[model samples]
Target: MILTFFDQFAIPHLLGFPLIIPAMLIPLTFFPTTNRLAQNRLSTLISYTSKTITKQLMLPLSQKAHKWTNPLFSLMLMLTMLNLFGLLPYTFTPTTQLSINMALALPMWLMTVLTGLRTQTTTSLGHMLPEGTPTPLIPMLIVIETISLFIRPLALGVRLTANLTAGHLLIQLISTATLTLFPMSYTLTALLGTVLILLTLLEIAVAMIQAYVFVLLLSLYLQENI
Candidate 1:
């Protein structure tokens, strides 16, 4: 039995061996099966779905920013797969950790900011102080804008981490309660089981949506820069 709810978030172990390597490798399974001239139904479906999603994602982006399409699409798929992997009976989710999310967020965010600064120097700095600002309030407004600018990556990381963590915790809580109540009342346990199933389904949707959101927001940030 798990000693604590948080322990489940920890790298699991078996016979005193940590499963971190396997956990890390699980995401590799998320990639497309193969690159063959002729494909089966599953491969065809994956191809169509990816094309559709990437097409929508790229719509708002300029041609100059179209280069980001692959990275953003891959990220969407990776996060979606990783999150879904965690829903299984035994698996760890790296995205649940703020550090990992930050590692993903900060670099992409930095790249966009850097791209903006390099290509549109005047425009980038102009964002800090809008065209018509009272002289006295300019200092305070600049400080606020700078703070907001730096907070973007942190917000991105925290958002993904918090959502997944909360969902996992709730699922664990409900599952535990269902097990505990099994002996007491068949009706109640069955009801809890039903709720658990529905919650899992909702979490599945959340997993996909959150991945899309992360990629979408990054694209929006890129849009502002490029």
Candidate 2:
């Protein structure tokens, strides 16, 4: 019975074709095309909003890191859309998959680290040990720092996956309870229904917040490198 609840997270297949592809594509439909000048308020708003966000995100980085603004902005938008899209009825969340999250996280994290190494090798390696550590603690500190460095990507992926999964599960459980009690007690059902609505709203906020947080952390990582 518990496993049944988790079944919702699994990728669906129809006639051996993965449904995730369509799910991923659905969010793109909401975006305004850049083929020409925006003729509507919606497109204009999207353009302005995107530019503002990109500028704000890049504000903390060095001039050299400005090259990453477009990619980071794109990542934030994609993740935000994917997360919000999942909240709709009968839609799937691609980011909820550990493999998907890791796939996104690992490369981005590695890029920042590699950029640091390539641009400032000594500084990057120096991060592994403090400037004035005692001789005995140097080896242990380097080992600990190395492990922590490697764990950053894993932490990013897991944080996103766990929060989304937990929120979805709670929504499912509450919805099931509300439906099951509908005939038994109208009052209780109404109360639970109200809670369910509020929870759904909160989950929506969580979805956006998590996406922002993911991009924000990546920006911080980039700042260290550049």
After TM-score superposition, the amount by which residue 210's alpha carbon in candidate 1 deviates from its true location, in angstroms, is 0.8
- Stretch of 10 with least lDDT, candidate 1: 29-38
62-106 per-residue lDDT for model 2 (tens digits): 899899988998898898989989999988899899999999999
The alpha-carbon lDDT assigned to residue 152 of candidate 2 equals 96
**Model 2 off-target regions past 4 Å?**
35-39
| Cα lDDT listed for each candidate | 0.89, 0.91
Clashes of 2: 0
- Work out the TM-score per prediction: 0.93, 0.95
lDDT of 1 by residue, 62-82 (tens): 999999899999889888888
Q: Candidate 2, clashing residue pairs?
A: none
Q: In TM-score terms, which candidate is top?
A: 2
The segments of candidate 1 whose C-alpha lies over 4 angstroms from its true place after superposition are 1-3, 13-18, 30-32
lDDT of 1: 0.89
